[model samples]
Target: MKLTLRLGKRLNRSWQVDAMLMLLLGVFGAFMAIPLIYVINNAFKPLDELFIFPPKLFVRNPTFENFGDLLQVMKGSWVPFSRYIFNTFFITAAGTAGHILLASAAAYPLAKHKFRGHKVLFTIIVLSLMFSPHVTAIPNYMIMSSIGWIDSYKALIIPAFAFPLGLYLMKQFMEQIPDALLEAAKIDGASEYRIFWQIVMPLVKPAWLTLLILMMQMLWGADGGSFIYSEQLKTMHFAMGQIIQGGIARAGAGAAVAVVVMIVPIVTFLLSQSSVIQTMASSGMKD
Candidate 1:
């Protein structure tokens, strides 16, 4: 497919095929956005509107009663709602930050330096991404159980720091950083640590931001699964699950709870969306 490029410093006429592709993309975007809009609309919809025949796409009569009901439900919980909120935020923040730092650190050497086993090491990491997390759940549980990390934040945070996808993406992005830049820093007497911390990391801001968005979304919605037996250690996602399992009377509140659960990741994405786009656009390119 041929795409029309804009002329330098000026608007240019679009090719007919390019215009058709743009129109198709616009339609696809709208199709993709429907679920998000529906979720937002549901949070404001009354129960009558929710169960109406044919099921309206948008809210007919919006109200805050659902949020009000959600607050009441949360207030009735044996554990304070604030505790659940704290656990969720604490886990998300720690996991996302640690994953970015560790993934980036591990990626740098694999990317810029060719060690004896670098190819095999990177290939292993890439292959690890092929298996779903569920495939290793039993092993993870056994290890966590053996190490006594079960029911603790460490079970969630520590494992996240070694996420292969982050390392793979970070390594790929870092490979795009020219070797001459690192050599220049070395010639200026920059220590390896200084080169990595001050020079390399700043240059890969877009890649790390993309990782932040990815990790934040994954870790934020974590329900602690089998690893967390303690209620106090549970995340907002767990609480949301509980609310959603409520019968029809709780429908409105469930929508509100869904909104609460989704907002953080959406906000994080919005903040770094441009950087993510840039990283994704050029990630396949190399020096």
Candidate 2:
């Protein structure tokens, strides 16, 4: 009877610990959510309301005027916002697709095939990740200039395809696949290419989706504000900057643009990977 009582006490203590941890996590989550809520609320508020003393937290006259003003500015701007969107879309799509294809193909050989220098090559690739993009920016700029790719999509898209981090990630994910599966395919007269395309790609869907989400976030949030501004190309962020500098009358418009820009990537991310996020979280735990 004494031992049963002791076990019950220990179980109760464990439950109490779990409840306390959950409460702490809830509080942490609320803290992180505050900034996002503030931004969203301010986006809907008028300029005067934003600067009002004590700050308007829950009360504000929400209006679509900010959105209208932003659209008007976009229409009047010298830079073609539509064209900039197209340009960014092309660069992001080409870069992402290229990264996935090349990285996955390269990873397959490294992970599955036996070859001399494979480890050395992978080591070099991993080491390359340590090199900051800023360190090579000057050299890359010179090369791009020499190749006459300056102020062109090629300048952005081509270089992005060479992401060492993507390659390393694909390699690590592929390593989890069993070697016997490939061997069985080979015994059945399947070529290495067929095995990879038909068999391996499907199994690593979670990893691929995770990488896709990451790549999209990187490309979408790119510091193209400066590059586009300097080149006189009107990206959404550049357009927003122009609005911000216009005057207080345009503050609401700037906020509107900011809200739109922020929402697009976030919505795209959530919609595309809502299912995959759970898979990634669980898989990562196993690792």
- Scored by CA lDDT, what does every candidate get? 0.91, 0.76
lDDT tens readout by residue for model 1, 1-287:
44356767554455876688899999999999999998999999999998888878899789999999999999999999899999988998999899999999999999988989999998899899999998999999999999999999999999999999999988998899889989998999999999999988998999999999999999988999789988888988998899989999999999898888889899999999999999978978877
User: Candidate 1's C-alpha lDDT?
Assistant: 0.91
True-vs-predicted CA distance for residue 282, candidate 1, Å: 1.2
Off by over 4 Å in 1: 1-19
Cα lDDT of model 2 overall? 0.76
Which run of 10 residues does model 2 get worst, by summed lDDT? 225-234
Return the TM-score for candidate 2, rounded to 2 decimals. 0.85
Give me the candidate number with maximum lDDT. Answer: 1
- Please list the residue runs of candidate 2 whose C-alpha ends up more than 4 Å from where it truly belongs after superposition: 1-18, 53-59, 223-234, 272-287
| RMSD of each predicted structure | 2.6, 4.2
